[model samples]
Target: MDLINFWLENLPTMIDGLIVSLQVTGAALVVGIPLGLLLALGVQAKTKAVRFSSMAFVEIGRGAPALIMLQFAYFGLPQAGISLSSFAAAAVALAWTTSAYTSEIIRAGLEAVPHGQQEAAVAVGFTRIDALRFIIVPQGLRVAAPALLGFSILMLQATSLCFAIALPELLSQAYMIGTNTFQYLPILLFAGLLYASICVPATIAVSLLERSLSKHSA
Candidate 1:
């Protein structure tokens, strides 16, 4: 079929783009999730300044659109005497977004752990930090893992937004191919399928993870 032939012809270029996409997603997760955990803790800190600052960051990151973040990183920062390549800009922006969103998810997970557990840890003479480290955070993060995995999948899809900044990600590659061949539909469809191939499996894995966690907890 024409579509199959078209895909075969373009597969190598698309694969290259996909590798970049995966790299970006991996980098974002590696940096962002830890930052998110810190932000979640900061929001829960007793100090008003720490809490407020954390809240402000989370609000701004969550409030602005990811596209705007990407644009600002790539285009806006140069005006302020800071410059980053498109790949660096995209990674930084996406990481910020990931941290902001995942902080809330992580916070909810922390809260979901019962107060009784903290008390039990304290009664055993554990310091507050130890209680959190030994009792609260571990369980909370486990509870949050599935949701975080799901979000990572969403972020992977959101890498398409980087195309606007001229990152040679999957969608960008497809667009370039389409522009050259003037075969928009087939190329775009192949791009869609490529995204689906990753996301669909990731989604199913998250579901399985959630079920397994539920069973383990029960």
Candidate 2:
């Protein structure tokens, strides 16, 4: 009951932090998903150079942990005469991770489009770009929708890691409250519940979307 009371009292401050988290996540997704689509296409490029470069980008992004990336963006980059604010660094790091992983998700969807679809487009006088734009991409994105939504939920959860760089996101705010009150256990528990508050409903929505898509496909 005390924990409940604490959560209620702190909810407003935590909500502000949650808003910052959402902003970071939105920045990541806006930049990342489109880049992911490009990477997916790049990997399939006719030029080996482009393909290899895209592949390398994906490997590096996927290989590094996001925490390290955030640290590097915030701390390490300053040594190189580059600097980003906490929000910028968090957004950039998360976007890199999102793009790397989502590239594969999108690539899988793109590949699932029947080869005949391309052929059909070609037969209809569509260029490769046109085919992808008007046909392949739309269909592929629909197929990928559920997974992308689920990944978005994970992305929101991932924002917690931004606490390491002092982004003042939800987790960071919770940590701040804990430090101030010296009630780390209860405050953190409330923070975890706050995360669950967002993620649990999102997960359910994703599942329902998946089932609806499945039924339509069937």
Candidate 3:
């Protein structure tokens, strides 16, 4: 009963924090996915410099831990005279991670497209850019959608890493409440439930979408 009362009192605050978490995830996905697509194309570029630079970025982003990236953004940047608020730091760091990982996913999707399709497009007098825009990119993105959605869910969960930087996300809010009330287990459990609530449904949806896409392609 006391725990219920505590939850009732803190629900509003928790919801606010969750909203921030969602906003951060949404912002990262919006910016990161497009950047990912560009990096995917760059990875396939014929120019040596562009390909090497893109490869370096993708490797570094995938190699570094997300937590380290968060710390670098929030703590390390100030040493170089670039300062950002906690939210901005968290968003940028997570977006960088998202872009790197998703680039590989997108690249795989692009490669999955048959070479014959490109040949067909060219034989039809389509320019390379036009073929990519009309024939390749759309199909590739569709094939990649399920994986991208799964990654987005992972990115949402990754928002918890922002707590280290004192972003007022769900985990941070729960930690603050735990500190005040000394009810660490219950508060943390509630926060876990909150994350599960979103992730569970998202996982199911992604699975369904994956199956559907597979069947459609088959």
Candidate 4:
């Protein structure tokens, strides 16, 4: 009861940190998704060079841990005269790492599009680009919706990386509250609730999208 009351009293402070968390998630997604799609397309390219280069980039990113990536961006870049704010460092690292996984998701989505559909689009006098933009991508995204949403949820959770860079996001705020009150369990519980509150809706929405796509196929 005391913990609940304390959290309620400090709701405004927690919310302030939550805003930063959302900002990090939103910004990373905005930057990462399109880049990921492009990377996916590159991976699918007919040319060997394009495919190999994209594959290499994705492999390197996926091989490294996100924490190491975040630390590199925050600590290492300054030596190169590129000083980034904690928020910026976190966002870049999240976007880079998430893009690698998202690229794979997108590539699989693209491959899942029936070859017959692409041929049908071309038969109707649509350019290859038009077919991809219209028929291929739409179906691919529908097929990929659940996976993409799962990735988004992962990205949201990964925003906790901001704490390492001294960004006062949700985890950082919870840490501060825990340190001050010496009530680690309560602080962590509230943080977990906050994370769940953000993720549950996203999961539900994605599940609905997947179901709808399944019905359309049926």
Candidate 5:
């Protein structure tokens, strides 16, 4: 009853934070997924310069911590007087981070397609671009779905950065409630459970997607 009452009292704040977290995650996915596919394709280009540059970008983004990226987006942009909302900052940072991972997944998926399939498409009068668009990406996405969704779960976790920039997110809200109620442990535990609740469904969805792909491949 105490735990229930505590949660009920803090529900509004927590819900607000959850909304922000979801917004960051959702916005990042909306923008980053397609950009990630393009980056993967660019990284595989025949031209050494294009490929190398794309790979370099991916490596740099992936290697850096998401918190560092959030800090950069939050502080670095202001020096140029190009300030963004915390939501914008969070979205950009999360998307940038996710794009790097997604690019790798996409690259691997593309590679997983048998070389013979590409050759067959070429023999059937399909241009490289057309073949890639029609035959390759469809198959590649199936291979990549599990990884992509897994990355999204990661990105969702990463959205915890909203606190640093003063944007209320789930963790931030929990922190606020804990600060007020002096029940830090319980608040944090509840917050963690909420995050896990969201992640579990996503993880299950990815597993199901992988199974569906495997069935199709078989």
Candidate 6:
């Protein structure tokens, strides 16, 4: 009853923090996925400069830990004269990480596409850009969708790291509440449940979608 009462009292604050976490995740995905697709293509480009630049970006994003990325965004950037709010910093770091990781997934999907398709597109009077925009990108994105969805779930959990930067995300809210109440265990567990509430459903949905896509493809 005490635990229940505590949670009920704090639910509003937790939910508010959860909303901020979701907003950051959404913002990151919105920016990252497109950048990911472009990086996927850029890394495969014929131009050496483009390919190298994209490769470097992907490598750095992947190599750095997410915590390091967030810290750099929130703390380090201001030293270089780039000031950002905590939310903006969190979004930027997560987006960079997402773009790097998703670029590989997207690239694999792009590569999985039949080479003959591109040939046929060119043979049928379609310009390279038109063929890619209309056909290749669509197919590649469809192939990558399941993996992308799964990654999004991971990103939602990763948003907890924003607590380090004082973003007042779910974990941050829970921590503040714990500090006030001195009930760390129950509060942290509640935060974990909140994360699971979102991630579990998303994970199940991604699995179903993947199975459906595979069935159709097969």
My TM-score estimates for the predictions, one after another, are 0.98, 0.96, 0.96, 0.95, 0.95, 0.97
Error of 3 at 119 (Å): 1.1
lDDT values for all models: 0.95, 0.92, 0.93, 0.88, 0.88, 0.94
Off by over 4 Å in 1: none
lDDT per residue for candidate 5 within 157-197, as digits (tens), equals 88987788887899999998898889998888888888998
> What is the Å distance of residue 30 in model 4 from its true position?
0.9
| Better-scoring candidate (TM-score), 2 or 5 | 2
For 41-99, candidate 3 gives per-residue lDDT tens digits of 99999999999999998998899999999999999999999999999999899999999
Task: Compose the digit string of candidate 1's lDDT tens values, residues 180-203.
Answer: 999999999999999999999999
Candidate 6 local lDDT, 71-119, one digit each (tens): 9999999999999999999999999999999999999998888898899
Decreasing TM-score order of the candidates: 1, 6, 3, 2, 5, 4
Off by over 4 Å in 2: none
Better of 3 and 4 by TM-score: 3
> Lowest lDDT 10-mer window, candidate 2?
209-218
RMSD of each: 0.9, 1.2, 1.1, 1.4, 1.3, 1.0
Write down the TM-score for model 3. Answer: 0.96
* Leading candidate by lDDT: 1
- Distance from true location, Cα of 187 in model 3, Å: 0.6
lDDT of 3 at 172: 95
Positional deviation of 108 in candidate 2, in angstroms? 0.5
